[model samples]
Target: SQTIHQWPATLVQPVGSPLSLECTVEGTSNPNLYWYRQAAGRGLQLLFYSVGIGQISSEVPQNLSASRPQDRQFILSSKKLLLSDSGFYLCAWTAENYGYTFGSGTRLTVV
Candidate 1:
């Protein structure tokens, strides 16, 4: 079975601080990885996606960035976090629309 893991589960950061969130998958190979941000009014936004290592695509331009340096590892990073960046961050993987398995998710609260 395949599974995804994300942490630190929840986060509280001040505006203009740095941010880093890690996600990894188990039991799958070469899966397409995606990073999504769920804001209150904005709905779900695709921040980045990677079909393979070193191949990242950004769907929206904001304070978020994503990287896939390993086949099963994905990371979301921000040098300067914003209050608007506060929301739910999710990592998901898909096998051609068969479906996406999301991580536990991170509730980021920025002030």
Candidate 2:
């Protein structure tokens, strides 16, 4: 009975502004969490991932950073946003024999 939750389903951020998105998984233990971004009409791009607490791996060197504060909580942050950062952000967790489960997602638009 595990579920993933992502906050701020949608966001409109200005250029050069700070941004923070949160994701948390419930009813699971030591799950693999990941952050992905998808541009309009494009395939998803992996941003970051964590196999365990305090262990994060960045897929691309962009204007984004991720952290796993608690065992089931993950955070994505940016000091200064860019126009290219606008996309659909997704938080997912790998389940045992259930594949990957995703959150409701957050659509960020940078103007």
Index of the highest-TM-score prediction = 2
Error of 2 at 49 (Å): 0.5
Q: How well does candidate 1 match the true structure in TM-score terms?
A: 0.93
Residue 98 alpha-carbon offset, candidate 1, angstroms: 2.4
Residue-wise lDDT of candidate 2 within 12-57, one digit each (tens)?
A: 9999999999999999999999999999999989999999999999
Give Cα-based local distance difference scores for all models.
Answer: 0.91, 0.96
Best lDDT goes to which candidate?
Answer: 2
Candidate 1: deviation at residue 8, Å?
A: 1.2
What are the TM-scores, per candidate, against the unseen true structure?
0.93, 0.97
Q: Model 1: how far is 31 from its true place, Å?
A: 0.9
Cα lDDT over the full model 2: 0.96
